[model samples]
Target: MLRALRTAALGMSAQQTSVDNTANNLANANTTGFKRATVVFQDLLYQSVQRGGEGDQRPAAMQLGSGSAIVATQRTFLQGSLMQTGNSLDLAVNGEGFLQARRPDGSVVYTRDGAFTLDADGRIVTQSGLALEPDLEVPPETQEIQISSDGVVRVRLQNEPDALEIGRIEVAQFSNPAGLRSIGANLYEQTEASGEPQIGPPAEGGAGLLQQGFLETSNVDVVQEMVDLITAQRAYEMNSKMITTSEEMLQIANSMKR
Candidate 1:
């Protein structure tokens, strides 16, 4: 009975995590450059109640499981919807890799969201206003801007027909992206298990190509999330039923003792 209760509790806990993950993905469905995360679970160790032996001894009988554990929260590298914003500074990745941004604390961060804006000081930044890495700063006198597919920043010269090169956007890549831990802020932190981040220009190596005036929309599918929510809810109910059944069995055992 105790084992049954523990197993039910663990199963419900794992299902709760799955529901949470799916809910979060649904919430970020419209978020730019947002990547969907899937929860991975594994069963706990099984206990053998019946021991194996020769000479008329029964074979080992295995317990179902103690419970389940959230093994990992894997990020879906699958591409999101690419929507054109038509803004000069607004950019999106056409392929893989992330745009590097510098935080206020001088720490570097990465994002797949390419919806960028130019600050009052002519500095390129995200909507949340995090400055782009490599420091793309346009001159005060610059009239127009143009970002190449390769991520080169350029500005039109005054009274001139051509644009001048400024800087290139820096992108980062990872080896084991599935190992990344989500620390909220729609950001991921680096870990030894994920390996060191590989920094490079857009489209260089496996880095994704940059698209001017485009933004990467979240990849979450609403219908899929709905189905998952229903499944999780059902699993939670089943676990509750297991607990009830275990309690009833215990009650029956007590009646026999009486």
Candidate 2:
């Protein structure tokens, strides 16, 4: 009975983690470059029971198992559809890699969201106003802005029809992105497990080609999440039933006449 209770508790805990993951995805459905996370679970250690009679002499080693555990949290890197916002600062990645942004604390962060805007200083900034790594600055007198297919940023000068180049956007990648830690606000931090960030120009080394005037949407699949939710709910209920049954048996055994 005690073992069953422990198993039930572990199952409940795992389900809670799954629920949290799903809820977070729903909340970020509208967030740009926000990758949804899923919790990975693994069964606890298991002990084998006796099998064959001849071999049973080896002591079946009474079967035992610990509850489940959270093995990891997986981030989905699936590409999101692009939405055209007609803003020069709004950019999207057509393929692999992520954009490097400069956090306020001076630490570098990576993201897929390119919904950018200009700060008072005419510096290119993300929707959250974080500056890009390379830092592209436009002239305050420029009337219109344009970004080339190769990620070259420039603006139209009043006296010149030609667009004067400003700066090129830089893209980054990791050998194992699953090791990244989410720091909230659609930003990811590098870790030893994820390998060092590979800084390079867009469209290089499997990095995504930059697409200006657009933004990448979240890649979460609502249908898949719904199915997983059902499975977790059913498994949790079954574990609860097992615990309840074990408790009833214990109660009945204790009721016997002393």
Candidate 3:
């Protein structure tokens, strides 16, 4: 009875984690460049008993599994749908890669959100004021900005007849992008498991091409997340019922007269 109770408790704990992850995904369904995460579970070690005897026609060793646990939460890197906002500053990646951004401490972070804006110094920056990597500076008299699929930034000045090239935006890739640590605000930090970032221009070396006037939508599927939430809820309820049944069985056993 105690083993059953403990097993059910472990199951409930695992289901809680699943529910949390599902809720987060659902909440970020409309977030730009958001990636959905899923919980990975692993069965606990087994308790062995009654080893088989040699040449005695007895079965092999029998074991009872302790339960399950949430081993890891894996981020899915599936490509998100693109939303055309018609904003010149908005950009989207059509494939694999991440845009580079520098934090206040000068540390680099990776992101798929390309909703960039200009800062007071005319430098291209994210919505949170972090400067984009490579430090592009738009001239004061710039009348129009244009980004090419190849990541070239061209601008037309107020008095200029021809467009001039400003800079090129490059993307970074990792061997295992899912290994990155999420630091919030659509940013990701590299880790040993993620490997070093490979920086280069778009549409090269497995990097995605840039799409001007568009933004990458969150990859989370609301219907799928809802199903997962329902499944997790059911699992939790079942675990609770198992604990209650086990407790009732213990009560019945205790009521038996000697």
Clash totals, every prediction? 0, 0, 0
Q: Whose lDDT is greatest here?
A: 3
How far residue 120's Cα lies from its native spot in candidate 2, in Å, is 0.6
Assess the local accuracy of residue 66 in candidate 2 as a C-alpha lDDT between 0 and 100: 78
lDDT (Cα) of model 2? 0.84
- The pairs that clash in candidate 2 are none
Q: Tens-digit lDDT track for model 3 on 1-258? A: 899999999999999999999999999999999999999999998897656764675778778888899999999999999999999989999999999999989999999999999999999999999999988999999999999998999999998999999999999999999999999999999999999999999999989899999999999999999999999999999999999999999999999975
Per-candidate local distance difference test: 0.84, 0.84, 0.95
Least well predicted 10-residue stretch by lDDT in candidate 1: 54-63
The candidate that wins on TM-score is 3
TM-score of each: 0.92, 0.93, 0.97
Residues 35-123, candidate 2: write the lDDT tens digits. 87888889898866555344636533566787897888899888888988888778998888888889878999988888888899989
Residue 174, candidate 3: alpha-carbon lDDT: 98
In angstroms, give how far residue 207 of model 3 lies from its true place.
1.0
Model 1 bad stretches (over 4 Å) = 51-64
Residues 1-258, model 1: lDDT tens digits: 988899999999999999999989999998877888888889899776555674467565445668898998888878888898898887888887877888899988778877777899989887788888989889888899999888888899788788999998878888987666666665667777878889888888988888898888888989998999999999999999999999999999999967
